[model samples]
Target: MTSARIALVTGANQGLGRGLVEGLAARLGPDDLVLLTGRNAERVAGAVAHVAADPATRSRVAGRVLDVTDADAVARLAAELHDQYGGVDFVVSNASAMLTPDRSQSAQADDFIDVANGGALAVLRSFAPVLRAGGRLLVVASSLGTLGHLDPRLQPLFDGASLDEVEKAVESWRTALHTGTAEELGWPRWINVPSKVAQVAAVRAVAAERRDTDLPADRLIACVCPGLIDTALSRPWFTDFSGAQTPAQAATAVLDLLLTERVDPATYGELVRFGRVLDWHDGTPPQLPDGLLVN
Candidate 1:
């Protein structure tokens, strides 16, 4: 019998993360392993129960309490994954947070600090050692990060901004709004650049670094936007009019990409939407018509 294949997903208790777990379990066989994790122990347990209750998924389910913001915990989890499973086939970074709802009214830097920089980066670094060749790392990113989607005046946000920079900017924006100094009254609905760029860079780095490793094929890493998915993380403005997909539908697309078997280096760091790959600049995958879902 073949050993079980292992996949780890952060923030898997709900939303897209939850959907990805379900989709993968539906498609993959009994010998596959899926680890559902989140910051809340109860949510993690509930997610595990949800998967285990499924007759199809019961045999392959596992659970972990992982808050991606904890750097030491991430490193420890890496060690545990390596020791227990030998290696992992996939690592999905789905955790996220906001410094404040009103991007121009609050000064809470904790949100960006935890979500963009520490959380996403922790996901990458923690699993680097355990992500074997041929594995895939998919970061649930946003189209807002695309340099093109941003107003030309906002280019600086995407150009040289790091995760820390994002935190600072959000904090600045929040303060401005609170102080009634900004013209805008809403949160700056932009993608976090550090998280997005890190996903792409991490994949490339892993592939290049492991080019000569005894592994069979290079790992695939990608940043994807599931469009205006109906999730708690999204703004009401998005759900109000944007084309939105259910978490289940979005998960299906993500799983399809992860289980494709063919790992394309070009797909690394690119945005996958509507089951198609797109260039980051244009926000649409290649070979599709204009005004498609990606754009």
Candidate 2:
């Protein structure tokens, strides 16, 4: 009875989120449950039905409405899961702001707020305490979020502190972005790069706090980048798909990390892409191997 492994995924209605839920459904034991969540209940239900329609996965999938930006809503969900499932064994923080082709340029600054959530980091603040003892949480973050993306001069802002400090830094960047000084201030040309740095920063801070807690056992948390995938979320941004993988392909790799069930001390507070734990380089870009040849 206690052998049932419980897992949950945020933003499971589309794109990579749906892929992850499908991957979990296939990997987990017959009795295990994978809760597929989305901000919209109707969309979530539809996604679950589509993914779980297969007789093999139908029994393994469930749906719940979750808005990661809403703190109280997340708290309620956490409490409910605690009582109902005895706590969740796996959590994938995959909710991120989706940019549309018709989005107004004037509204871009406002979108920064969503970007600032750092997807996984912001949601984890509410969900971390509720994770089952010895459970794992994976943040669908990016390597672009590593400290190396920040200019060395501004990297100090993220040095050894709470997610609050990181949040504050993001607000500063947002203000600069609104004021048209972000470029002068050394924020990257790509919005995702700086925002991702915030995600990794939050993950690092929270992971350190978890290490000091009196929790039952290892509660592992880390940021994971699923690589460039051919999806609506990314297709508009990239001109090339030659190097990209499918959502299912990325999900398979991420699931391997989630189901590993134990943490590598080195990967404890890192941003992982595929299976590689990125090297932060202390705010310096990683140096390429000398004289490397490529065909």
Candidate 3:
């Protein structure tokens, strides 16, 4: 068994995910390993090469092909991790999809629900058993996904909803979208918003479940917004955004949560922005739409 710590990041072929893998490699001990994953084998290799190009991080980096939406692929990867590393110390669930503006509404909703929300759930469910106790699970989310943007009538339910309730609420939104009644039910037209909202809620629910089941009492699971980063996902709409941080800067905020030894109850299942925790249940207005990049 290896004594070095292990960290895995998904969708790391480009953008913030790539930056995150680089950042992790730079910070981890030489004996540590940072696994970068993506759906495309070639792209994953390219990212691995880029990160390994640095002499300081070269020996600490590797890559794998993984599509979060594919259950079999995720399960296979989990089994591989179990066999090789026993388990991982950190999992950055950075894989997500944002539909292009030209996509049809139904297509957009499908990508949001299936790729962003459902895919994240699949990753967490498949990897929960492989996440070492006291390890951190960081779900990269968006500030726009805050509960404040959700329907007022549904606020109370989300404020304290259990895992099952959150699942049902997400399903309800899916049904509404398919039935052409999402707007009537107060779901927003921005497809990514509802998906991320559910994603963040699910993170909280998962943390609560872990605590209630007495599993990994020290496990840290939370969602965070990386702030506006100049990435391919955001360049379309945020080319002139003055407050946008570089991908390297955004990666620091994520690493802060992943590498911290101290755990705070307030941070569990919370949406952290710019390294500060946000009150998910509070109805305060969310900060400006910083960028669209999920990471």
Candidate 4:
């Protein structure tokens, strides 16, 4: 018999997370294992029970209460995975907390940092160890994280942006929108480019690190732009997207990238947007830079 592929998905109890859990569970055979994780024990139990009730998926899915923010706990879980399952073939970091409440109000510098640490980097460190050789690590990131795409464009929105010119451009755009003259200037209310770009970079960085090492086996990491799914983090404008894909659609897209074997090494760390894979460049995807590891 073929060895069962073992997968672990964080924030797997609801919305996009739950959608991914169900989609993946459906694709894999009964022998395969998919661990559904959440912070709430009751929620986790419910998620597990729901999966377990389905005859085709019941035997393959299990539940675990995991908080990705806790470094120690994350490390311990990684070790546990190593011991119990030997290694994990897929690790999806889908947990994220938005600071819009703070952003719109008295959100302090610490709050933004908290999102980066707790919501972004923390998740990366947590699953670093459990990833099997040739394993795939997928990080669910926002379009806001893309540096060149948004930071420079919206200086006012972001107190400290990396790209000054881009920030200024964004500030100008923001001002135009507020003055009831957005139609004259023609600008969209929402910007998703930055987050999408940043997500790709983060995933690529991890994949690049794993590729350059002298390890005996190969591994891949890539970020997926889930389009727009209906979730708590979603903004009101998201409803307007006529054909906006649902959480299930996003989950399927993610799984498609994860299951595909023909992805070139050069494209490993790049962003896969709109079902098309592309590299990081200014405005458009760039060609692979030399001396930069692509494998």
For every model shown, what is its TM-score relative to the native structure? 0.75, 0.87, 0.89, 0.71
Worst 10 residues of 2 by lDDT: 286-295
* Alpha-carbon lDDT of model 2: 0.76
Model 4 vs. true fold: TM: 0.71
Off by over 4 Å in 4: 1-3, 55-59, 98-117, 142-145, 151-200, 213-218, 235-237, 283-295
Off by over 4 Å in 2: 1-3, 100-106, 115-119, 212-216, 282-295
Candidate 2 clashes: the total is: 2
Q: Tens digit of lDDT per residue, candidate 4, span 108-190?
A: 22333333334445556656656666677777754333444433333233332233333344445444544655334433223
What RMSD does each model have against the real structure? 6.8, 5.6, 3.5, 9.9
Best by lDDT: 3
What lDDT tens digits, residue by residue, belong to model 2 across residues 76-122? 88888778777788899888776543443224545545633744555
Which prediction has more favorable TM-score, 1 or 4? 1
Q: All candidates' lDDT scores?
A: 0.64, 0.76, 0.77, 0.59
**Deviation from native of the Cα of residue 139 in model 3, angstroms:** 0.3
lDDT of 3 by residue, 1-295 (tens): 5677888998788888988898889888888889999889999998899889977574388888888888778888888887898877888888867555555556567666776776677777777778876778888888876788777866665667776777788888878878888777776666666677788887887877775542335778889899888877776555487888878888988888888877777787789887688777555434434433221
TM-score: which candidate is best?
A: 3
Q: Which ten residues in a row have the lowest lDDT in candidate 4?
A: 286-295
